[model samples]
Target chain A: MKDTKRQTWMGLLARADAGRVPELLGQAGPSPDFEWLRAPEIGSVMVQGRTGGTGAPFNLGEMTVTRCTLRLSSGEVGHACLKGRRKGDAEAAAVVDALMQTPAETLMRSKVLGPLAEDAARARHCRAAKAAATKVDFFTMVRGED
Target chain B: MYVAVKGGERAIENAHAWLAEERRGDTDVAELDIQQIREQLSLAVNRVMAEGSLHDPDLAALAIKQARGDLIEAIFLIRAYRTTLPRFGTTKPVETAEMACDRRISATFKDVPGGQVLGPTFDYTHRLLDFKLAAEGEPVTAEQRDADPAPVPHVTEFLNRESLIEEAPRDDTPPPDLTREPLELPAARALRLQALSRADEGFTLSMAYSTQRGYARNHAFVGELRVGTVPVEMEIPELGFAVEIGEITLTECETVNQFKGSRTEPPQFTRGYGLVFGHSERKAISMALVDRALRWEELGEDNSGAPAQDAEFVLYHADNIQASGFLEHIKLPHYVDFQSELELVRKMRREANAQTREAAE
Candidate 1:
């Protein structure tokens, strides 16, 4: 619902520019050929691949990626680069960039970052709840007085 | 009263000194010199160069020393250093056909033009431990013959003549440098081969092994494996043409893969290629097999849904440094997330207890 186009544009630019989100904003234009930076989240890949450790093969490596740049009307730029895919991700990233830099930062935060952070928090809480449920408290009433 | 942590900087400085002391070990013990590490631990140097994507033996030696012999850490050090150094310029592609080979072999053909030369290899040597190496010893040098002047052409060139192998058209387009750019999925053959060459040897080997063991199986035969020094040329903007910048040791592999002919296509052997830094034949051969498997889609073969055939999957997760860094980062502070979870669980538990009590009553 927020203007994701602006925020995602910034992210796409940053992704294109080697994860460096730019400070100066200008007219966004078509990306050059050499923009994507391929940095994969390997820990997750390893964990996912390890689901059937005996069956799955895991590689410890990196890739060569390209990214694109776009500017929004709010004079903000966005960039994003992703792994294991092509520049088709650039369009979605451009929209997210457009929204991230708008007055809708709060809305975007609630709609996007907040949910992800909360889900992460919930996962941690579930682990803690499981651990805490195992806790034992011993109590004994005095026998003599009555 | 508890004191404020005013000496944080000093504490850091002292901790670094103590760490350095620990790294150096006892003062009485003979120090491991950089040259000693470079010469004695040459395989470590090759790995650092391969993974670091740099060719400086001295720098690799220094990184190995700094990293306390942890090869992966040494590679990380080398890579970080490589990133900081100013790029004077990139070299023109090395001419593989003009290589002065120290070692060359062909599994596809026993007798090929230029004759198969196994110049230096440990392939046939027995693995029995030799106790004579325990003490300082000098190896007897084999008599040297004056090497031939003519450049040995590549074995693939012969296959290209008859069109037995797929046409690997030479392109002048500049290939992407993986270090300078992030990796993307669905990479071209050039990009995939580039990543695999510098990928971790063990990782590359296992991935290649997996393909052979039926995962995205692409039957591959080593067309050729050659190790030698090749001239590296770079074009000077001032000169307007390319000139030899230097020469570097490289291991190049070409695999002849079974090409399943399509209705529109003819039956011909396809190629899987790998070229890597140093005398690393095993790494290069493995890389070639994986490279061919990754080419299934481009070649119009049926998508086997195998791991090796998935270029997106293979290229995205091949670097050990990236893998290790992310894997180790879980050790960093996450107490903030932990605290939030703590509150949520406490609230949930209290509400659950109340509901249970009410239900019992």
Candidate 2:
């Protein structure tokens, strides 16, 4: 499916550092009352891979993922599927996801998702930089055999 | 002929109590934290993730600590934990081409499009131990440079373009689940690869080494090896779209093996592939070689009667869990089985003695 606004925020929230989302969401302002459509539940998703990394698909294994669904008092439903068994993170993510559709969308986006995305980007860049330093640059040298 | 045996509950409980005490050896010393094991002993965590077939670093670390650094025991814990988790369907197959590679190398070419990024590797490190590390090692930082953000194409694709390497056919068939389905022989490549990915590292390594030593040798070269992180996306039924659940570190190895002309096909380069969770370069490479060795029959080459070429033997013995279970169970109480053997031996001895006495008389 195409990357929508909900998709972007959901991905960011899922990939956020463990337990970091709730702490951030706590400071994002007053907690809007929301009902648990589906309580925070832990499960596993069977991760699949392609044969030869490009051909036929195969099941590699499974990883832990926690997901939850919530509905705001204003009636917008939100869902979250994140890695690992961080119940608090899932609850916070689902709340933020629902709030993103409400009038407080701008407030939540700026306060919560914005910082999370920045942190993820910085981490990515740091890893890439370290890897880039290791890139091998081969040069032809004068050899007696040559 | 079966009877219930009891009355060892107290002894069993005492033994476990003793085991727990040993697990926390020397209370004076600082207790090893899960984060320490997860970070400092990252390789162990990687091995557990690969063989345990689960991708939780924290859980693997906790298992290692609980098992007292015994990796196989830790894997057993992880395997048991996975059985309890409700599976929330399979994700869309990860795209390696879109992986954000930290390390990528190709042996077939001097320089590839993405360049050979060595990443964090111990290949060039000296074997000498750093004695200072025994005390407290200083924090170290890796050198940094601007990274080129581009997809590193698979090296074999270059050969495929020119018809020099056999093509890997695209199949839409959903692969058989290794955990759910009973393992049957003459397995498909997908199933074989799945088993190999989670196979015992030592067993897979030895099998791969056999090929190097001319047991069904195929003149293999590392076409490409990449270690990187890729986003794992799952399609949500409620949303009618896929959402990125998380990312996992992967080690992928592609071995280009030399294939002579068969009766049906022309001479061309064949491929052996491996993909595993976490950064396990050695295991990935070993898996690739063994994968190639197992393809002899499918590739129309002579079977050569090698152990690595025998799919049944390789697949059956590859799992450490099954092998460990059967081997470890022998130590358990088996009085009936042992007593029956003893009685048979004694009866034969008595009969032999009577016959000897009669002859002498």
**Candidate 1 ranges beyond 4 A from true positions:** A1-146, B1-15, B348-361
Residue A23 local lDDT, model 2: 83
Single out the weakest 10-residue window by summed lDDT for candidate 1 chain B. B238-247
Please tell me which predicted candidate would have the highest TM-score against the true structure: 2
Candidate 2 similarity to native, TM-score: 0.97
Error of 2 at B241 (Å): 1.0
lDDT (Cα, tens digit) per residue for candidate 1, span B1-361 = 2233343688779989998999999999899999899888887887787787777666778899998899999988877765554444454456677776666778877667666666656777798898888977997544343334356666777787898777665555555555557777656555676688778888889889998998887788898887776654434343254433234577878888888687767888887777777777889889888888887777788887887777777877788898899999888555676778899999999999999999999
Question: On residues B1-361, what C-alpha lDDT tens digit does candidate 2 reach at each position?
Answer: 4557888999999999999999999999999999999999999999998899988999999999999999999999999999999999899999888888999999998778888899989888997998888887679889999976667788888889989888877777899988999989879989999999999999999999999999999989999999999999999999999999988999999999999979988999999999999999999999999999999988999989999999999999999999999999999888888888899999999999999999999
Candidate 1 lDDT, tens digit per residue, A1-146?
23344333332232332121221121122322232223221110000000011111122122222234455655555444332223454434544445566775565555544443454445334433332332223357889979
Error of 2 at A64 (Å): 0.4
Kindly report which residue stretches of model 2 are placed more than 4 angstroms away from their true locations once superposed: A1-3, A144-146, B355-361
Q: Residue A58 CA error for candidate 2 (Å)?
A: 0.7
